[model samples]
Target: MTARTDQAEITALVDRFFLALDTREFTPGWARAYLTDDARMDAPVGAKRGAEAVRTAETALLRFARTQHFASGVVTDAAFGTDDATASWNAYMVHVHHSPAADPLFVVGGRWEATLRRTPEGWRFSAMTVHVVWTRGEPPTAEPG
Candidate 1:
C-alpha cells in the first residue's frame, strides 16, 4: 500500500480505538477485535500487557456512570523501514456519575501515544500509552445505602 493509504488506515484504526473507549462498556469482544493479541497499554494507573490486560485497564472507567473520550489533533510519525506507525493525539475525556444528592463530573486533559502495526485482520494497536496532563472536577460516587 502507498504511504497515504497506510496513513488513512492508521487514522481509522485510531478513531476506532477512541470510539471503543467512548462506548462506556469494555466488552471482551471489543478487545479481541480492536487490539492485537500482544497489545500493551501504559497509563498513570499502571501498565498492562496483552488483550485481556488492556480490557481490564480500560474497564476501570466503568467506575463512572458515563464516559466519553475525544481524540483529536492526531499526528502520526512513521518509520519508513518498519511497518510500525506511531501517533500522538490530544485527548479530552469526560466522566459523569449520578448520585442522589448531585451528579459529579470529571474532565481530564491528556495525550495519547500509540504504536500500531498492520495485522492479518487490519491495523491494530500494538502499544498505547496515556499521559494525563491535568484533571478537574470530581468523579462520580455511588449512592449510599
Candidate 2:
C-alpha cells in the first residue's frame, strides 16, 4: 500500500479504538483490531504487555466508570522507515464518569505516540504511549441537547 493509504488506515484504526472504548465495548476482538500481539500499554496503574494483558487492563479501566474519549483536532506525523512506520497525534479528550455524581470529568488534551509496523494483518500498533496534559473533574450536568 502507498504511504498515504497506510497513514489513513492507521488514523481510522486510532479513531475506532477510542470510539470502542468510549462505548464500553471492551471485547478482546475489538481491542486486538489495532494492537499487535506484542503491544504494550502504560497508564497510571502500571504497564501491561501483550494482547491479553492489554485487554485485561482495558476491561478493568472501563469498569471504573462511564467514559468518553473525545479525540478532536488530531495532528498526525507519519515517518516512513524501511519496513515500518511511526505516527504520533495529539487529541483533546473529555472523559466523563458517574463516580462522584457531581460533574463530568475532563482529561485535558493529550498526545498519543505510536509505532506501527507493516504486518500481514495490515498496519498494527506495536507500541503506544499516551501523555496526559492535565485532568479535572466537573459536577455532572444535564446533557446538552
Give the per-residue lDDT digits (tens) of candidate 1, residues 1-145.
7677777778787788778777745654667666778988888657889965675666567666667888888888767767788888999988876443243778889999988887788778888898999998875444313
Score every model by TM-score. Answer: 0.84, 0.77
Task: Give the 10-residue window scoring lowest on summed lDDT in candidate 1.
Answer: 136-145
Deviation of model 1 at 15, angstroms = 1.4
Pairs in steric clash, model 1: none
Runs in model 2 deviating more than 4 A are: 72-81, 138-145
Model 2 Cα shift for residue 81 (angstroms): 6.8
lDDT of each: 0.76, 0.67
